[model samples]
Target: MKIVKRILKIVIALIGLLLLTGIITLWLDSSGTNYLKINKNESQFGNSYLIKNVNIIPMNQDTVLVDKMVYIKEGIIKKIADTIEVNGIQIFNGEDKYLTPGLIDMHVHVWDRYELGLYLSNGVTAVRNLWGMPMHLRIKEDAMADNIFSPAFFTTGPKLTGSEFVGDDNLNLSNPSEAKEKVILYKDRGYDFIKTYYGLDKEIFDAVIEQAKISEIDIVAHPSQKVAFSYHLNPQIKSIEHAEEIVQQPLQFDLDVIKLQPIIDSISQSKHTRYSTTITVFNNIYQMMMDDSILDSESLEFMNPLILKVDSENQFNRWFNAKQEDSTTVSRIKKQHDFHITIVKKLHEAGVTIVCGTDAGIGVTLPGFSIHKELAFYKEAGLSNYEILKTATINASQTHSMMSQLGTVEEGKIANLLLVDENPLVTLSTLKNPICVFVKGRKLNRETLDSFNEKAKNRKNLMASTLRYLENLAIGK
Candidate 1:
C-alpha cells in the first residue's frame, strides 16, 4: 500500500512539473519579448494630409480619374475632388503618380511579427492568416491597436484536421461532438474564422459547419480527399483553397477545357464560394523541385535566415532530392501547375470570384514578395491587369466581408493607399515597388519602408526560431 501511494505521488508531481513548463513556454511565446523590434515612425494618427494632382484608379471602376486631389483626416478619406481648401495639412506632390487601393493578400501563414513590415513595404495593406495560435492572437490585437507596423490583420484559429495529422497547433477531432466543441472554443476565443484542413471527415465537416453557423463564425477550408469537391462548395464555406482539389475531380488529366463548364457553373452559382489562387507558391515549389532555382529572385534577399535555413535543409532539399530520383514527379507537378492556371482563367471568365493568395511562408513563397508573383501568374493566365489587380483588392475585401470599409479608394473609407511611379493598370509590375504607402492614414515613405525590409532580413529571433524548429522536428513536419 505504501509503495502504490508513493508511486501515485510521483506521478502527480511529474504532471505538475509538465503543466508548469507548458505555462512558462506559453507565456514566453506570447509575450513578444523575443520578437524582432523595429522602430516605429512617430507619426500621429488623425493628422491631415493632402495629396495633390494624382491619377486615381479607384478600383470601383475600370477608369482613372486624372488630376485629382485627395484629402485625408483622422484615418479616413474626407474628399476626392478637383481641389480641397484646407490649412495646416501636410502636402505631398503626387504629380505624374498613380494612387490605388492598397493590395490585400487573402491567404497567408504568418510565423512571426516581423513579416508584418514586409507585407506593408510591398503594398499589402491587409492579410488573412490561415493558421493561428496564442502568439498570432496577440499579434492581431497589437496590429489592430496600432502597436505594430502591420497590415490590417485578420486570422483564423488553429487548423482543425483529423487525428492522422498530429501537431500541437492542430485540433484533431475524432467525432462530431469534438468538432462542435472545437468550433465553439475558437469562436469564444475571438478567432476571426475557423480553418479546416485536408484530413477532415465529412461527418466532422458537417458538424463544424453547423457549429460555425451557430457561433456566428465563418469557415475556410481545403477540400478533404474523403469528400467530394461538391461537398465543400456549400454556401457556408467562404472559400476553397488550392487548385489541386478542383483539378483532381474530373479524373481525366487532359480533358478539354470545355468539359469543365459544369464545374465552373456550379461554383459561380454558389454565390458565397470564392476561390483562392495560390498558383505562385505551387510554381515556386515546381521550380525548386526541378532544380531550376535555389530560391525565387524576389524572395532571395528578404527571407529570414533561420526560416530559409530550415526550409532549405528540410522541405526544399528533401523535395528536390526526391524529384531527382523520379523525373516523372517533376512532369506531374508541371502539368498540375498548367491545369491550375487554366482553371483560374476559366473561373474568372465564368464570373466566379477569385481572391489573390500566395500561401506565403511555406516552402519558397516569401511573405511580402510572393503576392506580386501571384499577381503576375494571374496575368499570365490571361487576366487583364485590371482584373488581376481586383483579385487582390476588391475581390479580397469582398471575400473577407470587409467591403463596406475597404476595397476602394473613396471618401469615408479607411485611408490605405499606395502611390506608384507608373499606372498599375497598365503595368502590374509597378505594384512590386511602391513610392510610399499610407497604412491607416499614416504614411511610410520609401526610406522608412526600406528600413523595415532591412530590419526584417537581418533581425533573426533565435529563441523563437529555435522553438519552432524543435516543434517541427518533433512532429516530423
Candidate 2:
C-alpha cells in the first residue's frame, strides 16, 4: 500500500512538470514576433504624399477623374487639382495609374494582428471583424489611434449562440435571461456590435434583439434555422450573413422565385437590414468538394501557420474527408452556389443593400485575396465593376455609417487610397494587385507589401495560438 501511494505521487508529479513545461513554451512563443505584426516599423510613418497625374476612380461616381494631382497631408486628402507642386511632400509618379478609395471588407475573421497588414497590402483599408474578444478591443483602440500596419478595426463581441453550442468560440446562452445579460455585457465591454449565431432559437434570439435595442447596440445575425428567417428581418437586426444561409433556411432548398422574391421584397421594403456576400466562401466549398488536391493551396501560405495546422484536423480535415463523398453532393453544392448568385442578382434588382464580405480566414478562403474573388463572383451575378465596387466601398461604409470619413476618394477625407497600374473600373483584376495602398495616409508600396505575405507563409506560431485560445476561453470571450 505504501509503494502504490508513492507510485501515484510520482506519476502526478510527472504530469504537473509536463504541463508546466508546456505553459512556458506557450509564453515564449507568444513573446516571439515571427508572424504577427511583422511590419511593425518597416514603413516610415508619414501621413503626407503627392501623387502626380493619376486617374482617380472616386467611388462616389462611376467615371474616372483623369490626370489629377492629389495632395495628402496629415493623413487627409488636402486637395486635388490638375496640377499642384508641393514644396515638402514626397511625390509619387502616378501617371497612367488609377487611384481609388481604399476597399472595406465588412466581414472578416481576424485572428492575429499580423492579418491587419495583409488587408492593407491588398488595398483593404478598413475591416469589420465578425468575431471579437477583449484582445480585439485593444487591437481596435491601437489600430484606431495610429497603427500604420493595421486597418480601421470594427469588431463584434464573441458570437452568441444557443445551448447546442457548435462552435467553441461562441458564448452559449442557455436561456433568454442569459441571452439578455450577455448582450449588455458585450455592449459594456465596448464591442461595436452584437452577433447572434445559428444555434440560437426564437426565444433567445428575441431576447438578444430586445436587449441589443435596449443596450443601443446593433445586431448582426447568422440566423438560426430553428427560428423562421423572417423573424430576423427586423430593423434592429442590421445585417444577415451568407447567401447560402438564406437558401438553406427560408428558401428551404427551393429555388422557386415565388418564395425567393417575397423575401427580397420584404427586405427591400423595410430598407433597414443588409446582406453580406460571402459567395466566395460557398464557392470555395464547391472547389474543395471537386478536388481534394486543393487542400494544398499555395495561397494558404499567407494564412497563420498555426491556424492551418489546427484546421488540418478541424475545418481542413472535414472538407478533405468530404471529398470521399459521391458526386451528387458536389452537384448539389454547385446548384446551391448558383442559387446564391441568383439570390444576389434578384436582391440587387429589388434595391436591397449588399455589402461585400468574404468569410476569409476560414477554409481556404484567404484574407485580402478573397475579396477580389468575391467581386469576380459578383461579376458573374451580372453586377458591373462600378456596382461591384460599391459592395466593397460605398455600401460597406454606409452599412457601418462611416460614409462621411470613408468609402470615397474626396478632398478632406482620410487618405485611405489605392493606386493600381490599370484602371479598376475597366478591369477589376487590377485591384487584385495594388501598386501601393495608403491606410490612414500611411503608404505601403508594392515591395513592402510582398514582405508581409512572405513572412506569413514562412513563419509558424503554434504555442502562441494555444496561449491565445486559453486566454480567450478563460475570459469567456
Candidate 3:
C-alpha cells in the first residue's frame, strides 16, 4: 500500500509538471510577436516595391488606367502615381492585375483566434462583428493598437436577445427598463452598435432603441413579428437582417399605409441607418430544410474543399444530424427566405439603402468563403453584378461608417485595398483569389497570410490536445 501510494504521488507530480509546461508554452506563444500580436516594424518579410501600371477598380467611381506607381514605405501606401526620385524601390509589375478596395466582411464570428488569420488570407481587410465576446473585444483592441496583425474590427459587444431566442448566449434583457439600462451600458462600453437577436418584445425593443438613439449608438435588428417592418421603419429600429424577417408573408395593413409609405421612403434614402442582409444564412438553413442540390451545384466552385472535409468529419455530422432531427419548433426559415428576397427586390426597386452582408462563421457559411456565397444569393435575388459588388465593397463600408477611409480606393482614402488577378466587375468570384491585401498601406500576400494561418492551425491543435490530456488526468484515466 505504501509503495502504491508513492507511485500514485509520482504519477500526479509528473502530470502536474506536464500541465505546467504546456500552460507556460501556450502563454509564451500568446505573448510572442508571431502569435496573437505581430511585429509591425519588422521589414525583413514585406515587399519594398512600387506596384506600377495596374488597372484600378475604384468601387464608387469609374475604373481608371492612369499609369502610376504605388509606393509602400513601412507598411503604408506613401504615394500614388508620384514620380518622385526614390532609390532601391523594388518594382512589382502589375500590368495585368486589377486593384480594388480590400474586402470587408460585415458579419463574422472571429471569436476563435485562428479565424482572423483565415479571413486575412482570403483578403478580408476588415470585419464588423455583430456579436463579440470579452476575448473578442481584447483582440479587437490589440488589432486597433497595431499590436496584432488582423483585419480592422468594429463590433457590438455580445448581443441583446430575449429569453425566447434559441441556441444563443447573449444579454437577455426582459423588461423595458432593463433593456434601457443594458443599452446605456453597451454604449458606455464603446460598442460600435447594438445587435438585436430574435425575440425582443415590443416594450423592451422600444426601450432599447430609444436608449441607443439617445446614446448615439446605431441598432442592427433581426426582424420578426415582435420587431417587424412597421417597428423598424419607425423611430426605434432602423435596419433589418435576414430579409424574410423584415417582410415575409402577408400582414394586415391595419396601420395607416399612408403614414407608413412616407416613413419607409425616408428610411430608404437615409444614410444614418442601413440593412445588412445575411441572405447566405437563409439559403443554408433553407437548403437543409428543403433541397440542397442547388447549394452543392452553386457553392462547389467557390467553397474551399477543406470546409467540405470538416463538414464530412463524424464530429460535425453528429452535431448537424442531432440539430436537424430536433423538431420542437423550427423557424419559418423557408417562408422567411422567399419573403426576404421579395422584400429586398421591392426595396431595391424603391431605391432603398441595401447593403450586402453574410453571417459568415455561422453553422455552415464558413468564414472567408461565405462572402462569395452571399453575392451569389444577392444575384439570385435579382441584383446585377455591379449592384451585388457594391453591397460587399462600397455598401459595407458605408454601413460601418468608414466610407471616407476604407470603402473605395481614391486619392485621400486610407490605402485599404485588394489587388486581384482578374477584374471583379466581370466576375465577383475573382475576389476570392486576392493576389495581395493592403490595410492602411501595409500589404500581405496569400503566402504571408497562409503562413500565419498555418501557425495558428498548429496552435489550435496543440491547445485541444493539451486540454484533452488534462481532462484525462482529472478523471484518473
Q: Which candidate is the best by lDDT?
A: 2
lDDT of 2 at 323: 56
Q: Clashing residue pairs in candidate 2, if any?
A: none
Model 1 lDDT per residue over 395-427, tens place: 888875644577799899888889999999998
After the best TM-score superposition of candidate 2, give how far the Cα of residue 419 lies from its true spot, in angstroms.
0.5
Model 3, 60-179: lDDT tens digits are 864655556677665555666635457886677677688887787776765345667677777787888876555456667787777766778887755777867654346666789888
Ten-residue region with minimum lDDT total, candidate 3: 248-257
Candidate 1, residue 328: how far the Cα is off, in Å: 2.6
Candidate 3 residue runs with Cα over 4 Å from true position = 1-36, 44-49, 71-79, 82-91, 163-168, 234-238, 247-272, 286-341, 452-477
Each prediction's RMSD to truth: 4.4, 3.3, 6.9
**In model 2, what lDDT does residue 252 have?**
79
Residue 304 miss distance in model 3 (angstroms) = 15
Q: Which should have the higher TM-score, number 1 or number 2?
A: 2
For model 2, the superposed segments whose C-alpha errors exceed 4 Å read 1-44, 85-87, 319-325, 402-404
- Selected candidate, larger lDDT, 1 vs 2: 2
Taking all chains together, each candidate's TM-score versus the true structure is: 0.87, 0.90, 0.75
Error of 3 at 116 (Å): 0.8
